[model samples]
Target chain A: MQVRKIMCACGSGLGSSLMVEMNIQDVLKKMGVEGVEVVHSTTSDVHPGAADLFVVGRDLADFIKDVDKDEIIVLQNIVDKGELEEKLRAKLEA
Target chain B: MAGMAEMLKRENVQIVEGVDSWEESVRVAVQPLVDQGYVEARYIDGIISNAKEFGPYFVICPDLALLHARPDQGVLKRQLAVTVLRRPVRFKEEGPDVRVLVTLAATDADGHIEVMRRLATMFCDPDNITKIAEANTADEVYAFFTAPIE
Candidate 1:
């Protein structure tokens, strides 16, 4: 909600992030949220102000927890609809 | 981009439950692709190696693990294989027990985006995953992917 772009990341950037991106896109669509771009990236590709939100797996989230907690969305299960939707809803409603 | 339903053909699926360890699970998951020349033997090594290095970050959910490495490591093509164990295996100490293994081989960074999307759609739902976990045939499980997303 803060930025139009949401970055989905993993270790190598290309693999699992694609899957998480897909889930995020689907959830955002169902939420009627539009114009938000989901960027698939790796840890190396992420930096300050690189994205509006950083969505990553729990392991990688531990590394990024120091970043803006508001922008960092850590997922225990990348594909869980409830988890993804709830986090996005909280951030957007805030 | 081949959707997951297309990439994960009936031939590429294995339902041999109760694999001894996570290592054996990955080896069984990707062996079909290796035999068909879709991926190199080292692709298996790449998955296991990455899991060791990253501590099963591939364990995407409570019962699922999607394993992969740099496509340049050993991928011969953009493809994937799925293996559902009879019971979950501990991938890491105190981590999630994984029963489903998805070994991914992409030709390049973006090569498998659509396929991954389909998988994300299929596995995202707990109900769908429950159906898949109980499915006895690849077609039965794959039906979940081909079904129109609601």
Candidate 2:
């Protein structure tokens, strides 16, 4: 499947977003998933058409109410590395 | 670059390994410098404490080589001293080798630049990271770190 884009959101748009973006790229590469573009953004900057799926930190979960729940994936903690890959892969496939 | 290996050879540096938790990781990373008496033990604790209170920031993933930090604290800032990338720049599961992300945040951008340059010069040696990861004993790691850099 072709993953055109994936948007990662964090509170500051500096730390967490960068971390998630890097991880996503790694996960995609490992899964042999390609054709995806990853971008980082703050909660305020997120808008439709910016990307297909939005990955967010647990703290910022409430901020993405307007976004469809299916399109939004929230992390309760950062330790779920395996779960992240599975969730993202499922999203990209769908 | 002086590299961590050369730094290990210096009289004032030390290195420790197998640190799994965030607090233990900082303690191990900074303990060598403290043993050589370059930095006071109390000071090292302060940094670890601050990082703990402010952190839970980054988590080393199960792949053993990858790291992920809280998105909120993505851009790490440190006021002084040597810095190691707290977050990994990239991840590859097949290779056991781990890449740590580090940044030095100073009072100003210029300070950050200067410190980064010094660190880059100090840790740029090809075998530096290999030596650090392969080290078996704290003293061995310390010796590798304090060694003079060319």
Candidate 3:
């Protein structure tokens, strides 16, 4: 997988998911990792093969394990750019 | 992007010293918006239910939680309510302890995108969180996000 598409998710899909999406985009841009598309989603809307990567909270990590496909990343603070930068670095590099 | 000061109104911003629980905090924080007819009664129910099902997904940072419900659930408008609690409220035992709750309602998927974008940037600043926590009045809270978006 090329990891071209990323989907961020929270409980309701409206608030925090979008927050994560924007932060992820920021990291990708700062890292100069281009051509990657990031989107927002909810726990119920996620499934296997929907995207190259899935970003979610650790609490909801189990529910999406079936679809994680070895690319489900969990974060303590979704809006913290430092943490996001560190985590996304490994994936974007991989 | 719309900053938090503009996204939230003075009437909707609250400074409560104490709250019973995290769940109650969300309910109480969103009360103003509910009273103002910006959100429906079930919007509260939806936010609580979603939190229960998925844990505290909105605990975006160490001291903040952005409360929300799905647009299809019961949202009638794009509005935000800020409630600052003197004591920290923990949505889940393992989740980040939050001192402020910003209840939000969006009429459509993209209605609140700009506000959320601005908030994501705000959440990146650790210093801003401290300033927000020290704010004593709703107007003070409104002033915290008045700066132009970066």
Candidate 2 B-chain TM-score: 0.38
* Over 4 Å off, model 2: B1-150
Best by DockQ: 3
Checking candidate 1 for backbone clashes, the offending pairs are B17-B86
**Clashes per prediction?**
1, 24, 0
TM-scores of all candidate predictions against the true structure: 0.87, 0.45, 0.93
Residue-level lDDT tens digits of model 1 in B40-91:
9998888888777766778888788887877777988787777778887888
True contacts kept of 3: 0.83
lDDT of 1 by residue, A31-76 (tens): 8988998888777677778888888988777657446887888887
Candidate 1: TM-score of chain A is 0.91
Q: In candidate 3 chain A, what residue range of length 10 has the lowest lDDT sum?
A: A61-70
Q: Which scores greater on TM-score, model 1 or model 2?
A: 1
Docking quality tier of candidate 1? medium
Residue lDDT tens for model 3, B1-150 = 444555678788778888878878878988998898888888888889988887777777788888888888777767888888888888877756778788888776566787877777777887888788779787888766556665
Report RMSD (Å) for each prediction in the order shown. Answer: 2.5, 10.1, 1.8
Native-to-model Cα distance after best TM-score fit, residue B36 in candidate 1, in Å:
1.4
lDDT of 3 by residue, A41-76 (tens): 887878887788898877677778578556878887
lDDT per residue, candidate 2, B6-113, as tens digits?
322343232332345555545544544455544455544554443344333322232122112221222232232222323422222342234332322222222233
Q: What share of the true interface contacts does each candidate keep?
A: 0.58, 0.04, 0.83
DockQ of each: 0.60, 0.07, 0.79
Model 2 residue B143 distance off true place after TM-score fit, in angstroms: 10
